[model samples]
Target: MSWLLDESHLADLSRGATLLGTGGGGDPYIGRLLVAEAIKEHGPITVLDPDEVDDDLFVIPTAMMGAPTVMVEKIPRGTEPVLALRTLEAHLGRTAQATMPIECGGLNSMIPLLVAARAGLPIIDADGMGRAFPELQMETFSVYGVHASPMVVAGDRHETVIVDTGDDDVRMERLSRACAIQFGGAALIAEYAMTGADVKRVAIPRTLSLGIGAGRAIREAREEHRDPFAALAEFFAGTIYQNVRPLFRGKVSDVERRTVGGFTRGGCTVAGFDGGELELRFQNEHLLALRDGEPVCVVPDLICVLDDTSAEPITTESLRYGQRVVVLGISTPPIMRTPEALAVFGPAAFGLEQPFVPVEELVSERFSEPVAV
Candidate 1:
């Protein structure tokens, strides 16, 4: 059923999206503020459940593309996403009936709301990735063979650039990232303009609800004086997210970071109170995780680091030495574990020289057989 989006929903969505971000997607704070401002100016946004969308309605998936750290310095003009959407619609010769997130994490999760509220369109409760990935092509849409061409890129300093990269999603990502650099490290994008039927078939279903539920679960746990991380694990039990488990709890012992080619790349070491240590590597998002030098988790799966006491997520850009943290991992969706999907987002794709192992397989003692959705 379709529902209304209000500030409370945005708050939970921000929190849940941050956790689901898997230590990337940029902070949700700025996006949340933009969304709140848009709502106040234009009134509540109508959020359409994916199933209720008309099959022929044109849905535009949108997000901010570039370095998350850079975005903090260059605030959006608020018109960028709307402009990108309109540009894409013009390029496609059709008007968008709705807006949807490319991923349900951080800025990308809330960006579609800004577009929806400004454009007077309903936002869909779905996304390409149930969680976030650093690369644009690493999504369910591409896994299902959706063409990511004919995208629109817009920013405060550049003319809107329309892209048509044929069947190469990777090339499209390269072109978009370059545009982000030219536009001063971040740009708003509207891409994968598809019919509603296409979205229903390829998008991760009800991810918005999943994020909201996660946020609410965490908040409610805090209110009731319970363990928030425990609440998160329990809540994921009934969601499409599978085999959720806390991987490690430690204090940051080291960080090696740099910004290269408009992306944040680095690794951090967390030393447990028990004297062991875990390592996490990232390129914009947490991609590889190791427990005492053994490969414990890899990409396509999720590796989320959170505040030890508050359960707030720590994105790669914000990770620093001396912060107490909890590391959690969850199995990627079954659809994302196929051979084709793995080829795009597996550990090898990240240039890591290790075999891709499912999080469930890596730590079977921490996971049960996932319930069929």
Candidate 2:
């Protein structure tokens, strides 16, 4: 069931889905220009593939939770996930045969192709974090216990909220981050109501064909200039953060935000590659990757920052002051090595004191470098 997929493979599936959006899948170039302007005004969008859905169908995953700097200053009015999946299919009386993707990184994988081309529905290509994580029960759907509040949410005007709660997924992420801070931060949910065989048993399979083969091998290694990170390490096998530290890339001299308990925490400080001074901390993503005080990196892994050179994904609330970032790290999210994702984003859940270390064995055995592109 392939309704559509051709705008040059959604620009190589938004460049390998923005490298698994490990930098906190937020900046996918305005969600790949809103999935190429909703596939050039809703033209192509069939793409179903989780074995064509049907094992009793009724899938449902959608996304865009909140704060990639308020999703580029609140842009999505695009009928909020088809009005939160048709108001959760009229409160679940049946009618959801397809439409998936909860994560594949950055702009939550072109927001299910602009919410399945403006909610005409039929975008089942699998997701649920084949990459990209900041929260929302960090993929693998609450590590199998799955259940994110009877779920349904559709804002940007149409207004809807479902959330059949029982105080699960932490009271459904505190009532979906307080309705994404009252829809000023972002919302559009449409969550976990699986079926298609439990959405292929907690997704992550064929994640949109691995975001179209990591967005067609980094757009054919940048049109043959070659070396799009060695063609994404020939489609990464995993565990490869070989000692990466770029606490400084000259600019962003500073940045800091705070939202507290509800979580928004932030920090930034770039200067210049190794002259001195460097600091990075974030909560909406990028946990810790210091240098002037030690601890090269920490968190459940991943510390990304990019955009230092069109690498993209920069959002510590739209970091500023020059803006040339680099920070990187990859390795984490196997359910963050369990123990309940290391008790919520390991290293003492960001209060850090030293414990977890798996940014690909802390970058191939403590920062090694030399594999540059």
Candidate 3:
């Protein structure tokens, strides 16, 4: 079913996207404000399901590419993404029938909405990555035979660069990362132009709606004074992300983060109230969590940190010492757990020594005795 995405949906959608981002994907607050302003100028956006799109329709995925830390400090001019879209459309000599998110992360999730509203085009309710990752090549589109070129990138000052790497997604990532660094550590991009048929085959379906649902569940749980983490688990009971495990409840003890090579790379530790510690590592998103020197959860599974009291997600860039937080381990969609998908984004892809294990398996092995909620 199709639905109108107006300001009424922004809060929940942003909240859910932030959770799905796994501590990366830039800041949702900035993206939400951009969408709200675009809607005020251009009206609500139409969101179409993958099944509803015609097989021949041309769709372009749009997002911000850069370090999340830099993104928060270097705000977009609200014109960068649209400019990239227009440039890509011109390069392809075909008007985009619709726009979609390349990844379902905080800011990236809303970029397509902003582009769609401003361009008077409907947005697709799907994305390449069900969750966010740091690199351009870490998308299901790339894994399943979609080329990410000729890609168009636009900066805040209207600077634009077109990259045509054919099927060399790694080269594409390298060049685009360099471009982002040149653009002051962030730039808007439109890549992986695909036909509706390809979208149906490769894109994760209904993730936008899924994020909205997760956000709504969290909000309702808070209003009723119930456990938001439990609400989150209940909301994802039958979805692609089938399990949600609370890995640790603690206060942040230390952080060592740095923005380098167009990526925010770092690690942090959370000291459990009951006397233990959880270590989290990331490139742009939370990729690994270790408890007492043993791997608890590793990507491509999600490692999310939320405020203990409010269940509001905390991005990696926002993690601070003394914050009371709960770390979660959420299972990824099966489509993303496939051998091919893992090869592109598994723990090895991020240079982690631990092998890729399902979050459910890890939970079953490690949590034979429940520690706490």
Candidate 4:
């Protein structure tokens, strides 16, 4: 029932988290680095299986809810989550047994670790989403009817709000975004206070292992001189997509960023691949992937734009002209295929009349045969 993720697993976990981010999860680097540093400093984070959680144990999932672009530049003062969690715990008149990660992609994934490390608590090994999302209400938490409000959203100096008005998740999302915008486009937040038994029932168990496994598959595949793409394809029933189009690789050519109705909206262009090309459009998280006007991938699915050689994630905010990069597409989860789920993230959601092409089918028709890997 006891487990620990070593420092060595960060990269794999990060990669997996990035994949799960499904184009909306912000870049995982900052989160990964923060968690890595904390692990290195305080020793690895102790993990527990969902079953290990007690029915009576109070659990609060922690994460970052703001523009990914602002995270790197602002450099968290590091006290937001620490303060937010403390405020929540204090209000509840009880201590938390373990901290949970609301979303496991990018910075959100790492925030819980930091909170747990700073507050000296055990971190539950599972989370609401296997990846990341743009809104707080879009998660396994919503499906489970776990209310995510009265939650504390904090700023660098510990300025915070304890919100709980029985608002729906989406309303909570809007409120958090407004708070982040007021705080200048980035809000470190935490929520979903539930007992360990509820967490055990609703949270996906050992999902972290999935990230580590997929990441290891990629590394081992490349090391063995096999097709890393194919290896990943097998890991997720996706096929290898070799049509890596040319995208500008350099400092961000130009960035247009703004917060609209609480959503962080903006896109950037890179100018190196061929006299300046390749652009990414994002809303707090990457939303669409285009290479010279051709759709490589889109949201409701996972599209990870990573360094060509190192496999590092380049944040939409941090991306610029002249930076070398390669974009990779992993299929989206089956959940997104359901008519109901698609209603929220399908092409129509982005104003595209295109129908939802399950990543499995997309990979099969666009890449290789549809075999696992």
Model 3, CA-based lDDT? 0.92
lDDT of 3 by residue, 234-334 (tens): 88876989888878999999999998888999999999999889999999899999988888899999999999999999999999999999999999999
Global lDDT scores for all candidate models: 0.86, 0.66, 0.92, 0.67
How many residue pairs collide in each prediction? 0, 12, 0, 18
lDDT, residue 254, candidate 4: 73
State which candidate has the highest lDDT: 3
TM-score ranking of the models: 3, 1, 4, 2
Shift in Å, residue 364, candidate 1: 3.4
Model 3, position 317, has a per-residue lDDT of: 95
Per-residue lDDT of model 2, residues 84-189, tens digit only: 8778777877777677778877778877778787766777877765666666766666566567667776778877878877537767777777877787777778
Error of 1 at 272 (Å): 0.7
Tens digit per residue, CA lDDT, model 4, 151-245: 88888877988887584877877777788878877878878888888887667666566667667877787678776554665666532222222
TM-scores of all candidate predictions against the true structure? 0.96, 0.33, 0.98, 0.79
lDDT order, best first, reads 3, 1, 4, 2
lDDT of 4: 0.67
The number of the candidate with the highest TM-score is 3
lDDT over C-alpha atoms for residue 7 of model 2? 67
